[model samples]
Target: MEKPSDNSGFVDSLEKLLQLCEELGQQIDEIGACLYPPQEISSIEAALEKIRNIIDVLRGMQWFLRLMRLGGLQGASDAFLEACNGLRSSLRELASEISSSNTADIEARVENITLTDK
Candidate 1:
């Protein structure tokens, strides 16, 4: 089997990340439509807003990476792409869990997500 090029691997991971983001957004919207406490809804909305900002930053970084590739500089290195793929997998698992969970369980599920630099 032929090995995939670095660019192709990065692109595949990026595409998956975007798709997962969209899925998570839809899930959040569905949750919003349900009758939850006003405060919980507000908190969810705030979290969604932060997610939107992160997506925007990702888009900007994607463009920057593309420019770097075009300029003959190294784009995302293997380690970076691996990290991104790991994140995408984690997000996918999170989405799966959220979708399987009841409305009341969502807060608990969301609370499980934590950010720590490796």
Candidate 2:
């Protein structure tokens, strides 16, 4: 099995997850630029879903890290646990919003929504 990056793997995972979220945000911004109605809800939602999945993976990793840290001086810190919970809650809310959007034509709109390297 592939071992985790470090004892603080959760922190590293958080950094990676945040980077992906930022990239997704940029994609949404670009998609919003050319689309009429100025709303690419479905594309935004697909990005959000990816972010949510990353957050979920990080949550599970944090749980394992917490278990490992049980006997250490730096046991699962409140800030770390709080962040995990917040990420989970945020992802859940984003998912709910995505589910409620009446979005379609994502594939057909791909040419319009794609961002040029400018």
Candidate 3:
């Protein structure tokens, strides 16, 4: 078991999560470029922007949690864990909404393009 003061694991995990958020943003951009209608693109872009904002909030929360832990605040660890879980749940739901919206159409279009280009 890792000690509470050892935050390397948490930092690494947060970094990975941030990286994944960036990748998701890029994919959204790709989908918007590929085949989404203009109106749909705007909707997707709005969601993507919200995701970017959420990522920023997550980064802020990570630093705040680290500082709180360093200050030896009571229950900081539990609070950090709870906050991380809540953010993760929010991200998951947002990702689910994005995927369910027009991802099938995007995937089908990409498949056709790939086959035709070969």
Candidate 4:
């Protein structure tokens, strides 16, 4: 079987990351309706921290991909494959973190979206 190209992997990773981010944003909006009531502020802060970390990782991966392309890695399929693997790992990590949040409502909404897209 032909191995996947790095560019394709990177693209897939980016798209998945974007979907996670959009869902997280929607979750934040939904949860914000509940008056934090001055006590659960810490939880809100912690959730924001996780969101920030995911955003930073996604941005860093994009930057690294651009650098690799500019460094002439584009012509080398092996190099591209390596880059793609790295991006895939990062994306998967972010997805795991998002899942760990246990935002069932958001998860359901995302699932519904996936179904509708089909």
Assess every candidate by TM-score.
0.35, 0.44, 0.32, 0.38
Q: Report the C-alpha lDDT of model 2 over 39-69, residue by residue, as the tens digit.
A: 5666666666665665566566655456547
Better of 3 and 4 by lDDT: 3
lDDT of 4 by residue, 1-118 (tens): 4547867766666677677668667645633542232323345455555555655565556564675577777665345445445644644653464556545544454444321210
lDDT of 1 by residue, 16-57 (tens): 667756865774665455324322544444555555455555
The reply for model 1, stretches above 4 Å from the true place, is 1-76, 111-113
- Give the Å error, residue 3, model 1: 33
- As a whole number from 0 to 100, the lDDT of residue 95 in candidate 3 is 54
TM-score of 4: 0.38
Question: Candidates' lDDT values, in order?
Answer: 0.56, 0.57, 0.58, 0.53
Expressed as tens digits, the lDDT of each residue in 15-118 for candidate 3 is: 76677668656755664564534335456555556655655665566565666677686496566567556655655755565566666655555455432211
Best candidate per TM-score, number?
A: 2
Tell me the spans in candidate 4 whose CA falls farther than 4 Å from its real position: 1-7, 34-39, 63-118
Which pairs in model 2 have colliding backbones? none
Clashes of each: 0, 0, 0, 0
Better candidate number, 1 or 4, judged by TM-score: 4
